[model samples]
Target chain A: MTEEIIIAGFGGQGVLSMGKILAYSGIMQDQEVAWMPSYGPEMRGGTANVTVILSDMRISSPILQEFDTAIILNQQSMDKFEKMLKPGGVLIYDPNGITRPPQRTDISIYQVEAVEEATRLKNAKTFNMIVLGAFLKVKPIVKLENVTKGLEKSLPQRHHHLIPMNKDALTRGMELVKQIR
Target chain B: MADYKLMKGNEAIAEAAIRCGCDAYFGYPITPQSEVLETLMARKPWDETGMIVLQAESEVAAINMVYGGAGCGKKVMTSSSSPGISLKQEGISYIAGAELPCLIVNVVRGGPGLGTIQPAQSDYFQSVKGGGHGDYRLIVLAPASVQEMYDFVNLGFELAFKYRNPALILSDGVIGQMMEKVQLGSYKPRLTNEEIVARYGSWATTGKTHDRPRNIITSLDLDPYRQEQFNLKLQKKYREIEEKEVRFEKIACDDAEYLLVAYGSASRICQKAVDLAREKGIKVGLLRPITLFPYPTKAIREMLGQVKGILAVEMSAGQMVEDVRLAVDGKVKVEHFGRMGGVIATPNEVVAALEEKIIKG
Candidate 1:
């Protein structure tokens, strides 16, 4: 199976790191993966996006014009990537700081209150992990055990103690997601 | 045993240099390739394996440092982006003229001047044809994936030393910034001083002894006749390299009626374009040149029998397309399509260009 995914949000919102974690998780499951980030001056404070592809076969074209999934965290991303999704693709987004929601009728849409939930949980950095958990809950493409292994590999050894907290946030995100039809 | 890890292309280049027992790296930080220097500094190979990694004052300084270290028979290297590479062109020419063995990496960005930090293949002519002022050629290796970015470090060094010529890894911003799974090689020990003297003692300036003549390293020849001889010798070496070291890859060519010629990141995109065209029952194939200087002329010429048309795809206006046209020699319909200033052409766009430029032409 192959999944072409685009994760987009503000630069400080862990968009790139979330893609990195997914790429690492794909490696844990012996899948071929490619992570291409939107870089350069635009990444200083502007909207940043990363294209992450996980496939059982060799991946071609890390740069793509279409995607099977679009994980949008901001309205700018939602406005841009909504039309780029496949007809029956999946779009998961957090309903925070978004003025306009996705308008596509063909694709499946889901929402996770990750930012508000992270604030309530008193850990602001686990927002991306929660979103990741919600995506997995909907697709179940990669195993939860592999994701844990991915976190262990991506996060530094000094931050190993924070895994349990992130895991909690992920679980909470999985519960907080609602299918918006 | 192969050790697997996830890493960016620039990070892979740094790690591979250390693993391959590179003696020194003298480079200044530049995007989107600064990670090569950052990762090397963080790893501190000087402490682990006695390798030296230094941030030079400028690109010129870094390339000259490579020249000096190579004169001593050390496996030295340096890396930079397009503009910085332009700054080192004079030194690169000198290195090529002196017949020094070294690896130079240019993770190219968009440019004529201080261009965008996004990826572009505009430096194709500058790399393979000669950006510097000389009739010299660098053994150019174009890597399409992060795995190739890791593997080509050792391969580049091997080729450089074999011919005593400067070798270049012509990467772009896309490969430099992208991350993927790569199987890394095992650690190799640096060559001991005795071993260096034993291997490169004939020409390397390791020190003159009572038993032998002093080895002098210089590209300068005041006499015009001697300079002409030297130029002829360099040309002969290049011809030998072309015959022995031309490397390329072919995909879906067995039943293809059309061909797409590309290299590096552009080639990776063309692989997907080939798939898309095949799905539409368009018999298209891809010819990705791994060694750009050798030009893969023979391979493209061979496609003239089966392929009816050839489309050259790059990130520039049209540089490699000239080489493709020359290879085909008007036997097949040839066309060019690209997006400049760091814009990457997508797979669907490439397919459309093929149909518009080659099929309908």
Candidate 2:
């Protein structure tokens, strides 16, 4: 099976890293993966996005227009990427600053209170991990053990101490995510 | 030992250069390819391998630095994007004329004069057809994936020294910025001055030695007949490369009615398009040229006999298609489909073009 996903949000939202970590997990599971970021000057502080294609077979063309899943973070991402989600696909978003939620009957819609959960944990840095946790609950494309290994591999050795906190955020996110339609 | 690591394409190029026993790297920062220099700067290879890493003020200065280093019989390289590469052409011509061995990497972006910073193959003509003023050709290696980006650095240097010419790794913004798993090789020690002198003593400008006559490295030949002879020598060397160094990948060409010819990032898209076309019961295949200069002309010619038509896909208006046309020699119908100014043609769109241009045509 293949999961063609787009994770989009503001630059500092860890959108690219989230895709990287997910891609790393795919590698840990011995799956083929491609992670392509939208780079250039506009990617500095403005809207940022990354396309992660995880597949059992070889991946072709990391540049994608439509996606199997659209994991949106901000209102801008939700509005922009909602149209690109395939019919009967998954649309997961953080309902924090979303003024207009996704209104599509064709695809499954789910909301994860990642921002609120990160605030409760008093760790805004774990916001992306929380959202990632929610994504795993919905899709489970990669096993959690692989994700654990991926996190350990991706983070610096000095930052290993923070793994437990990130894990805690991940668990909280899985619990807080609710299916909409 | 091969160690697997996940890295971006540009970073892979830098790491591979260090491991390939590179003597020096001179480059100016450009979008999509800046990481090549950034990684070299961060590693400070001078401390380890004695590789000199200098951020030259402009692409011109950087290429000249490569010329100087190559003239000394050292493995030197410079990298830039499309526009920056345009600035290095004069220096490139000098390096070629001097018959200096060096590596020049162009992580191409969309172009026709300061075009978008997006990936494009519009520089195909400039890279393979001699961007600089001369009757010279660069050994152009087109890498499609991040792993190739790692492998081709060492390969480019090896080919450069083998021919004593400036070789080019013609990549684009997509491969430069994309991240993937790459198995990096062990580090090789840079050749010592004695070893270089022993191998290149006949032509290298390694300063006067008491045992041998002073070596002179100059492209300037005032005598017209001698200059023509020099040009002919370069032509013979290029002909030899074309005969022995053609590299390409053939995907599902057996019993196919149409062929899609692409290189680099465009080839990746064409691969997916081939899969889509096969699913639609259209016998379409992909022919990806790894060496744009050598061009795999013979393979393309043979495939042209089997296929009814060819679709030359690119990220340019229509650059590589000219080469395909030249290879096919009008034996079969050939058409071009591409998106310029940084816009990439998706796999489905490539399939659509294949159906419209080749399959249905």
Query: How many pairs of residues collide in model 2?
Result: 0
Scoring model 1 with DockQ, what do you get?
A: 0.78
True contacts kept of 2: 0.68
Let me know the DockQ for model 2: 0.65
> Residue B17 of candidate 2: its Cα lDDT?
97
List residue ranges in candidate 1 displaced over 4 A: none
lDDT of 1 by residue, A1-181 (tens): 9999999999999999999988988899999999999998769999999999999999989999999999999999999999999999999999898888888899999999999998998888999999999999988888989888999999999999999988898898899999998
What lDDT does candidate 1 reach at residue B155? 97
Collision pairs in model 2: none
For residues A1-181, could you state the per-residue lDDT of candidate 2 as single tens digits? Answer: 9999999999988899899989988888888788999998749899999999999997888887789999999988888899999899999998889999899999999999888888888888999999999999999999988888888878989999988888887888788889999
Regions of candidate 2 where Cα sits further than 4 Å from its true position: B1-3, B199-201
Assess each prediction's global lDDT (C-alpha) against the native: 0.94, 0.91
Task: Output the number of the DockQ-best candidate.
Answer: 1
Pairs clashing in candidate 1? Answer: none
Top-TM-score candidate index: 1
Residue-by-residue lDDT tens digits, candidate 1, B312-353: 999999999999999999999999999999889999999999
